[model samples]
Target chain A: MKVIKTVNIFLAIAILILSVNLMKPLSITGSSVADLSDAECYFVNSGVSNDIPIDGCCYEVQKQLECKKTSKDYRCYTSESSERYYVVNANALNYCKVGGYDVKII
Target chain B: MSKLSEDMSKDVKLMIVLVVVVIILIFFNFDSYGVSGEAANTDNIQYEESTNTLYLDSLTLKQKIAQMVITYHKETNKERLQDLFIGGIHMGAKTSKEEFMNSIDNFQDGSIIPMFISVDLEGCANPFENFQEFPALNEINTKEEAFKVGYDEGKLLKEMGFSINFAPVVDLDDKIWKCRSFEGSPEEISEKAKYYIDGLQENGIVATSKHYPGKTLMLWDPHKYVVHAPISRNDLMPFEKSIEGEVSAIMVSHIIADGYANSENKPSVVSEKLIGELRNKFTGLIITDEIRMLGLSDYYSDVDQMYIDLFKAENDVILNFDINLDNLEHMISVVEKAVIEGEIKEERIDDSVERILNAKGVNVIR
Candidate 1:
């Protein structure tokens, strides 16, 4: 019985610790430096304009969408910097504006 | 026998104590589900079909606050929200047309005032992409195509029992999603948007012109936790046209602004200055975009404070998609407390409820 009591106490303590550490609400800690990767650089000129440049090396978004067959004016290109995702028409139009080389997704 | 009885007594006491502790925790957790401390206006709610009158005073303070909030639709929330008389249910991307219809029926089943059934059915941001395809706004060059798209989309949405369509994004530029904004100069965009608004509203679907105080589709600054947009005169034109066209509601974005339109460094959704300015130009419902977005929440240390600010901002409707019903109830309680304390006036609540009922085609009588 004493052994069981010790085990229960330890279990309760462990559960409390896990709850405090893991049950926090999710927060978006935005990037400090720009991520010019394809996934990050996508959605230029498609949803937003890239005419005016910001003071950054890369642009980060919540999500990156692929080029839809229906949208010809809206094309996505791969970013030469990261080689991971596609930067859309806006980013492709003015890749040099944001200080990066925009590579068209062939 | 006596020894056995004593041994059982200790174990029974321990069991009772454990059960009591659990009961207390459960009670605390579910407390948000019950009536809050606001002095409920007498529950004599009635609608006279003969006179077409809805007694506004009949609703309790909780019901009024519930009417101000539009929550994300979940199967679990249907019955609870029906009881709370929540004003609206926003449908996210769902699998099928049948699923969307069924969900709408379930939510509107026992609601006193028919809840506003809303969805984001824009050019590229189509939730109905699986079942049907709609032309992206950028692809629509002429006002004729824009009107046709709006009228067709509105007709289908009404058939599906959707009351509101958050579309015709009037942001002057769309550098992000090139397909969202209509392809043209500000004046041309305005003309197309006006035709779309007329098409939707004529079909009994409330058209909401959105991301107001403009420049929302601009790129974000990663260094800033809350994104800010530099608004220009061109950015205001589409919205001005939307108001002139008499759109039903305008959805506010989370971008902080300070140029032609100023949010005073606060996200436009919670900024009274911006909302108040828009109210001067438009008497329609001013709605906040999804309140759960990090851009709005990041501006506040305490989430409860954010809820209070949203109410104080005087928006006619608030979109909170927290998914947890308890958090929603907690939000209602916080606003109720603010109202009781005079931080937010009950009259303000009345004003919003009146507008909401008006939009729903119900006549409100004080």
Candidate 2:
């Protein structure tokens, strides 16, 4: 009789725990940024036009910093010293200015 | 005799325990079934025509314009606040959740009259940290998870004092990265959007489906410039499907579809051929996209002129987000001028105001 009473108490406690678990609040987190691949170099160079080869040197900077090259007359760099010359037009330069890109005139 | 009584007592005790367990199981099962049955009944109520009404009231041109335009967050001023009392303010994308709730609370204080507060909460999280407290301005995501999310948000928004939610963006994008198509595909969008709309509207927050005739091809943001959508009748199928749903409001987009059948180069907002003719097919309220978008302001070159043209086209509501309350006030005056000129009749203004007031469920007149 003692053993039966003990088992019943254990079963009741287990059922109460399961019910509480079912009532637990649900939380959902957004997974928006998980798919994006990290870029190697992040730079903001002015005078880099939209005509620049996006897959070459420009792709790394664009994907990393969300920057678009708006000019044909421009230069970009991994560091300040190793600057690569990229051509962009005047209209593209204006586009860069409007987009708040930092242009260094070398 | 004592042994016989002991056996009988054991049997009685066993019977009582079995009865109690059965009662507990039945109670739990019935409670679950009852909750779901109530939800199904509410869904049925949405389709009933008993809720539809045609409110006919005499309203001035100013009241009509007030009913149409919603101002952005930053454009609230004393004159602007006064204008909202006289007219309504268009809640803009730039407006934070906190600012909107505070404005609504202040408006409730009788300093400014209650105008319709419309928000684009499609892709945004609740901008207010304490949004739960207001209950009226809670944000909801359009996901499969939306059933639970919307219920919680809608319940909270009702508590906070919000009456309208410009939400459940039914615009389906074939392209994956349209920057704002967070909901689903065309069929999926319809299903999820219906669920989300029903959830919010059931809780009393009016759900508005936006970017009408769909926004799948909007390459450029209309806030900056006129966007042209290059799609055929196939793309428009989703919007047509969406209209068939229990949507309370439909917001027209500023996109121009040159390729659309007979709608060459004309933005949907000014296209009487589209918004007036096509949308008339659906018996629902029609609202224009933001007046300040490039398609409206830059393309037309005159906001007042554009409003007149749009009104002539039978566009019901003018949506503007940029906080230029001064411009909204001028727009109201323009509509008033049109009314006096006999271009737009007082009855038309009354009809529009009635729809606006009914949509907001509040009276403008104190």
Interface DockQ per candidate: 0.06, 0.02
Q: Ten-residue segment with the worst summed lDDT in candidate 2 chain B?
A: B39-48
lDDT per residue as tens, model 2, B188-238: 666666666767778877677766777533354312345677656645655
Q: Model 1: runs farther than 4 Å from truth? A: A1-106, B1-44, B49-52
- The CA lDDT at A94 in model 1 is 41
Query: What TM-score does model 2 score on chain A?
Result: 0.26
For residue B298, model 1's alpha carbon misses the true position, in angstroms, by 0.9
Best by lDDT: 1
**Tens-digit lDDT string for candidate 1 (A1-106):** 4444454455555555544433222211111123423322343433443432221112221112233322533343222122222333443334322222122223
Fill in the DockQ of model 2: 0.02
lDDT of each: 0.70, 0.49
